[model samples]
Target: MKRFIITEDGSHSLFSAQFNQQYHSLQGALNESEHIYINLGLRPALENGPVSVFEMGFGTGLNAFLAWKLADQLQKQVFYTSVEAYPVSMLEASQLNYEEATGEKGFMQLHHAPWGKETGISPFFYLRKEITTLQDFTPDRFFDVIFYDAFDPQAQPELWTEEIFTKIAAQTKPGGVLVTYSSKGIVKRALAAAGFAVERHKGPGRKAHILKAIKL
Candidate 1:
């Protein structure tokens, strides 16, 4: 398999590969994540203190990068836990040219952060990055927010099942939120069956909708 692929979407650039894909267009992905989840949802909650962010697919680390920047603004410590089965090596990882696409030097720093033997990235960000398949892993804590950024449910059917959502719900605090780009009936139903109060909200670019569930 190709280690890295610089794919283009119209005028937008996406760094893609076997494990991750990111729209390199200056916070295109980052902005969407921060705007919808953090700025609008998690930020309000973080006014009291720091927030712990758990992501299903860390992907290109774009979401983690955005969370780091948001943490600075909110003055909140963030604990990020993301699972990736295939992590791109540093050589291939460096091929991601988000800085060139976004004109921001900081975008590059997010991916370069140290990974834990099992538990954290840095003092400010606690990263429990288990470089293993999601199906084989389990959660450790009740997070404030969950970013379900896994690949499409059709491509990876097992990741979207009732059992998986049930596991995800187990790791969240009561009333915590889980946001995702999918609002399919099966997906929502699975989440509800697992005990979350699911809401279908408007998605970015696509007017259809997305899922925002509150833990009860």
Candidate 2:
């Protein structure tokens, strides 16, 4: 079962009984997404013209929404692809306070967008949400940015393996960036083994650091 919980930044995140984890940090969901994925990942990639992004998890659609908003603001095109094995239901998604917190609309529209095909969220942003696990997904094209937002190694160990990182690395373009809210030794080693130059950056809220790897 999944239930909504308010984070420190006044945004809503989901707690999944099956995973035994919250979708985002208890410190703040919106703050984390904006700082890690948007500021660190998407913004940098957008400088090189139209960007293609692949996300490992589409938990609350927060990252996607923020990316969409940024793309619109910059008037740059973004092709975002996200994969999720278990998607949040519309009812659960409706309970999120992201729209109110960010003062932006279209949170529901993002969730309501059909799965398995590309849909235009705005003139500058297009999204294709795949309903599958990272292990089962076959990438059709390379991406300029990757949001590796899978649950922690403790909760979902299989997704944090070297094999999974290698699979993702194969789909990332040279110089592409991959960002995640983890700085574990295993994660850094996996990224290095997958041909990435990994770096650790200061994290938001109570966390110490986050990982940002570049495809070599």
Candidate 3:
């Protein structure tokens, strides 16, 4: 597997091999995750009560970092779960500084906090990182918010299939929202087949659109 690659946007980072691209840039992947998913999809639901956030690809732990910081801000109890087949080494993990990027340092504790089947990182967030393949991530618990931030469908085609989404749908509570940076026809159809009310939303950078599917 290619350990690292640079994006066309000049963003450099490590590759998960599963997705075939670096998770995000040193400059703005943190910003985009916090702004798009955490602010838009997660914040509103948090205002009501405790928040449950599930991430498909926990690469570099950027999304999880942003989720923890936002949970602190919103004063919402947070349960964050992420699945990854390849967990980066501590050296590799240290290379990416999410705090400087997003102005959220609280996330750094998540890694140093420890790794296990289930653990609590802070008062607001209960984090669980499963070192297992995405296809093997059978959900024993449902989520209120699902962050479908996996690799691009082009690189990891199987992750975008209808059958995969059917499993994803099973984890989502009714009225739960699934958000991602992909808006392909097959992707949307698969989400629909899984019983989501799908919609196209504005994307972060050069990308024109993103997908937000509400489970019905």
Winning model by lDDT = 2
| Per-residue C-alpha lDDT of model 1 across residues 1-216, encoded as one tens digit per residue | 333434332223344454353433232454466556666456765776777777887667667766766676556788788887766556654666655654545654555655544444445555667777778876767788888877777767899999998898888889888888778888999999998999977665543687888898
Error of 1 at 30 (Å): 3.6
After TM-score superposition, what is the CA distance of residue 86 in candidate 3 from its true location, in Å?
Answer: 0.8
Tens digits of per-residue lDDT, candidate 3, 60-165, equal 7877877777778777788988888777777777766555655566655666656556677767888988888879877789898888877777888899988998
- Segments in model 1 whose C-alpha atoms lie over 4 Å from true places: 1-28, 100-104, 117-123
Stretch of 10 with least lDDT, candidate 3: 4-13
Write down the worst ten-residue block by lDDT for model 2: 1-10
TM-score of structure candidate 1 = 0.81
Ranking of all predicted structures according to lDDT, beginning with the best and ending with the worst = 2, 3, 1
Candidate 3 error regions (>4 Å): 1-12, 16-19, 25-27
- Prediction 2 global C-alpha lDDT: 0.93
User: Candidate 3 — what's its lDDT?
Assistant: 0.77
